[model samples]
Target: MHVQGVDGAEESNDGSFVDLRRSQAGAFTRTQAMRCGISDKVLGRGVRARQLQRIHPGVYVDFTGPLPWETRVWCALLACGPGTALTGPTALRKYGVDGDWRDDRIHLAVPHTRRLDRKSSVVVSRHRDLPAILHRTRRPLTVRIEVALLLTAGAHRDVSRRAAVLLDACRQRRTTPHRILAELPALPSLAGRSTLRRILADASDGVQSFLEHAYLRRVERAHGLPHARRQVRATTEQGVVYRDTEYEPYGVIVELDGQAGHADSISRWRDMTRDNAAATSGKVTLRFGYQLVSDPCSAAIQVAAALQHRGWPGRPRRCSPACRL
Candidate 1:
């Protein structure tokens, strides 16, 4: 038997070993090694010689030093054994939905019948319909984006965080509200199901983030303000851009900024350009960040003022007894 060592050139007279390590980011499970015909003695010798590094009990990577995030994910999956796939925030990250939705520990989903002892660095979730949700063809094995979003949202206790997971997934174009809604029925017991449904309804109308949802529910609906067209597309000198909320008839646009603020100078510049273009077109642009949005009543009042200034004769009603609107 011929075994090609991690070095790619060195060969050993052992059981035949296929080079499956490369596809898994140079990581493979002990069982995988054995399946490839690498004996326990050869594996132990590779580890002893520092050609293989143990990440988890049964997972080994070919190289030494720090492991990349992708490599770590592969190791985690291998450690959990077969029939397991990435889920929740870990899967969200893999799907390229950026933001605060990330977990330090690897999140995985397995069949309900599968039981494994918990590891500190891994979060295991059991699903009765795991097979239905798994993206079997995807490398690194992950749940579908819709499943990942729903699972991630269900794991969060905070309504805002939960909404953010679903919204961000759509905002980043990883999945759509319709896709999520279609998958919702599969997990009837999901936490915050009603809230998720409501959010998805609004999302269908272009609500893309928790802040936008807040502005819709608290500022617009609660205060009896005019329904603004959301995620309105407009062509500008800075190319095509989408407005968060546009009261087209009233010539007022409301921009909801996240707490994290502009990512860089280019983003800030683009925002300024967009606002300037709106002003040049005789439209009033009102920008609100986390602080202002947190006080929805106050935000409503400001938007109402802008709308009224732009010929919207409707008066904003107070949302509650304490509302200053």
Candidate 2:
């Protein structure tokens, strides 16, 4: 039976073979070649002639040069058989989120019942409800941004990395927390739903970094502190400033200092000026560093005191048995 070649032309099938090889990053499967009207004899001949390199049982790579990482992802998709698409960090990376994570194995999501052997360069994640989780992108085969972030949270081992994925995906991809939250009910299998929910809640409140997120979870939410407005913007002579978390009703602002210190003179001046501006506006600012954020109990106590001092009638409840409220 004559098969449809890469190019639509019939007589020029030979030329189309070459075009197809080049189009797919010099990688194709035996099935693809056969479907393209290329005979097994031609495939064998190409491999024997050193023009094609067998990268997997049925997959061949054109010996053009070093195979790019993206091409490898494509090859992994092909090798995983049909009904497979890129997911997790592999998909999120394309959306410009979490550049620091590097995994050698390409992440693919396939139907749950589709049993497949593992490949050295591929990691297969089975989703029982893949059809619901998958999203059609320009590539036509990728998990949605929220799905990718959720899967990534499961795949990553580090707590900070897990936390950062949510914040970074929202900030970098310009996706809203509400958009992510909307996907939760439809998600069939969730690895860390509570953590994801917390991150989404923090994101909705404008928590930006991992540390700030920790403060929101550990200090504020845990101890039942007053809900604070996050990333509150104010115009200042130095420039516009965003308060990390603000208790506007009580006129209290909480600033979370990152791991990196504001040692530079200009940054220090800007911070001082921002604090002065808040004070001038009759708002008191409470700043916490990495150490304080780590000790959530103490941070909550301080915040409770600050709110109470500002006429908050409610007392902060103990977050744990050991927490001295």
Best by lDDT: 1
Stretches > 4 Å off in candidate 1: 1-18, 236-239, 259-265
For candidate 2, write residues 1-325 as lDDT tens digits.
1222333422244556556666667677888777666777876776777666677789877674567877787688778888888887788876667556767668888998998876887888888788887776546388888878777876567767777888877767557788888888867567777878877887877888888888887899899998888888899877899888899999998988774548687777777888999999898988998876557898898899999999888888888999977
TM-score, per-candidate, Cα-based = 0.88, 0.79
Clashing residue pairs in all predictions, respectively, total: 0, 0
The lDDT of model 1 is 0.82
Write one digit per residue (lDDT tens) for candidate 1, span 206-281: 9988899888988899998998899899998778989999999989999988745597887888889999999989
TM-score (C-alpha) between model 1 and the true structure: 0.88
Model 2 backbone overlap count: 0
- Write down the worst ten-residue block by lDDT for model 1: 8-17
Task: Report how far residue 207 has shifted in candidate 1, in Å.
Answer: 1.3
- RMSD values for the candidates in order, in angstroms, are 3.5, 4.8
